[model samples]
Target: MSLASREALASARERLDALADNTAVDAAKLAEELAAVTALLDREVSLRRVLTDPAQSGEAKAELARRLLAGQVGEECVELVGGMVRSRWSRSRDLVDAIEELASGADLIAAERAGDLDDVEDEVFRFGRIVASNPELRAALADKVADRRAKAELVRELLGGRANPVTERLVLRLVTAPRGRSLDGGLNALSKLAADRRNRMVAEVTSAVPLSDQQKQRLGEALATLYGRRVHLNLDVDPEIIGGIQVRIGDEVINGTIADRLAEASRRMAG
Candidate 1:
């Protein structure tokens, strides 16, 4: 990772960081751009075909990738990718990792400020489960049915009103694709982005804030009781937690913050 090519990733990451805060960045445009990138990648297979041509040297294959990226994607894409080509990265994967990384990075940059879309997660998962559970769903997506519209319509029926526009469109694309025959892969693809989107590592913490020895001990015991397993506490800092400290375990943030207590008191008064 500390190689010269890593420097290109750093540069690309910097470019991407500037765009991350804008929630309105167009997914449709990004998807179109990514599709073009995938096409370029698919075309790169020819470079390997000539790699071992005895008359050709290693430099030739590197030059091939450089030209392709340069011509199709312009200087910025070309140079960053060209850096990788010139570097002695292994050719065994045939540059599959490089392509995948770029696409994933692009998606992350586009989705960075977009808040969580739980409907996408639930609907995509449900669609996958339905496909797996029903023979007809699998058949519709499979090559057995040549009508693309019908296959796509089935996907629409399953996902309509239940998923976001992005999920609806993307699921339609995948269902019409060959791999959609496998419910496992469809779910995996949909969930893959969600898992990637979930940037934070879940820390199931149980703590008495500004934890003293006895409170910490008792809080760990309580967390174990609630979680049904022992948890390591991050020991939050809050004076408002009158008796017990707040525990932040992943998305299920146990926010027994002083603010919550105040809100509850206000609610009772209003009633």
Candidate 2:
């Protein structure tokens, strides 16, 4: 995100946090309502463009948003969307993206309130792995021609009682309305959002075997020290790595595995 978008997101997050802090507000309903607004903005290009138009005054755009969303959504949802339009977005789509993020954040907050946030995060990661490992499943979820209702039912059947409710809802929403994102992309986004709820970065750690508890702690601490931010380890066992571990944080990879060394050596020899 650009500096402008980051500022906008931060401001929006403050509003969400305030809403979450209110004991009377229902977090789950807030999530669903925000998601509906996200869908509305996503489908209505002209409306999004108008809301994000630089030429229009922020207050004017906000009033328009409030008027459109007033009776359709809760007061909190109306205020939230109205606030979002009051900020400047770099692109029209950024507005929808921000709303989508808030929706995910709201769901995570619900899980946190239920003391199931960690479970939801792990479930999301595990579900991503399941989808990645099964080509048939991946194809089924990614099939554009398939009915979305059928796809959602398949998701419910696969995940129903097995995963946290928030996890199930997040995955179901992604599969039902991908918005041009792949299943992997959607899962990745959700995972990151889950981590962000705790103000941590996720490190995809691959090793030949599962790291011990002490080892996991040490690695997490080392990553935190290296990155200057709290790190959450998403451990993966890949025997192909031979030894050591490979850590990936976003685009940066710190490869210490024998497999990576050998691959580098092979490339150098070819060169």
Candidate 3:
């Protein structure tokens, strides 16, 4: 996203957090409503263009959003979409993207309220890994020609009674309506959003073996101290690493694994 879209998204997130904090609001219902609105906007290019038109007054765009959504959606959703349309977007598509992200965030918040957020986050990550490791599963989910119903049923059969309801629903939505994203991309986005709910960054940590609870705690604390923010470790075990750990946070990687060290030493020797 460009700086403009990031700013707009941050502002929209703040409003979403405020809504989540409200005791009277039903976050799950709001999430569904927001998803519906996202679908509507995604399908209506002219409507999106008009709402995001810089020539139109923000108030006018917002009012139009409210009028269109008022009867079909709850007041909260109507107001939320109104507020989003009032913000400036880098492109009309960015507006739709922002709405989709907000809808996903709302669903995570609902899971958080139910004390199932951790489960949902882990489930999303695990599901991503599963899809990546299984070629047939990944192909089935990503197959554009397959029936949407079959894909949805495939999700249910795989995840039913095994994952949290929120996790299942989220994964299903992504697979059924990927819009132009790969399965891994969609899951990563959701995982990041879930981490944001706790104001934490996710560190993908790969080690030769599973870390003990104490080790995990110390590693998390050390990373948090280094980053000046809470860090959530998503551990992956790779025997190829030999020893030590490799940590990835976004584009930055801290490599301490024996494999990386050997490669570095080999390069130094050649130099």
Candidate 4:
């Protein structure tokens, strides 16, 4: 995103925060509505371009958004979308991306308010790992030619009662309407968004064995101290690592597994 788009998105997030702070507002419904708006804008390129057009007055674009969304969505959603159009976006697609982000953020906020955010975050990461391991399932969800309804049903069947409602909804939306994102990419994006809800960083921790609660706590604390932010662990088990753990925070990796050590030693000998 350009600076303008980033600023616009930041302002929109603040607006979402205000809405979330209101006990009367339904964050889930807000999420659904924003997703709908995002889908609409993504499909209607000309309209999005017009809404983000610099020549048009901000009020005009805002009014147009309000008029288009008035009866179809709630007042809060209409106002939110209206405010978004009233702001300058670097590109029309940036507008859609910001709204999509807001949709995910709204779902995270819903989970947070319901005290299920931690579970949702963990569920998202675990689901991504599951998809990574299951080629058939990943293909099913990633199939663009597949019927949307079928994919939606598969998502619901997999997540319905087994996961938090917010998690189910977020996954269902991404799987059903990927918007050209690969399955893993979409899932990772959702996981990151979930972490950002609390201003935390996610550390992907892979180990030969599951870490105990104390171990997880200490590792999280150490990473937090290192990164200067709260860290959430996305734990994975892989016996192939043989011992110790591998921690991935974004592009950086802290490798301590026996497999990694052996590989390095073999490379040194080969050299």
Give the clash count for each candidate: 0, 0, 0, 0
Off by over 4 Å in 3: 269-271
Question: Per-prediction TM-score, please?
Answer: 0.49, 0.93, 0.96, 0.98
Question: For candidate 3, what is the lDDT?
Answer: 0.92
Every candidate's lDDT? 0.53, 0.93, 0.92, 0.94
**lDDT measured at residue 133 in model 2 versus the true structure, 0 to 100:** 96
Q: Which stretches of candidate 4 lie over 4 Å from their true place?
A: none
Which pairs clash in model 3? none
**CA RMSD per model (angstroms):** 13.4, 1.7, 1.3, 0.9
Best by TM-score: 4
What does candidate 2's lDDT look like per residue over 175-256, in tens digits? 9989989999999999999999899999999999999999999999999999899998888999989999999999999999
- Quote model 2's TM-score: 0.93
Residue-level lDDT of model 4, residues 51-84, one tens digit each, is: 9999999999999998899999999999999999
With a 3 Å backbone cut-off (N, CA, C), the pairs that clash in candidate 1 are: none
**Candidate 4 C-alpha error for residue 267, in Å:** 1.3
Cα deviation at 268, candidate 4, in Å, is 1.2
lDDT (Cα, tens digit) per residue for candidate 1, span 156-227: 787777666666766765655433236466555555555445432222333334567886688667766787
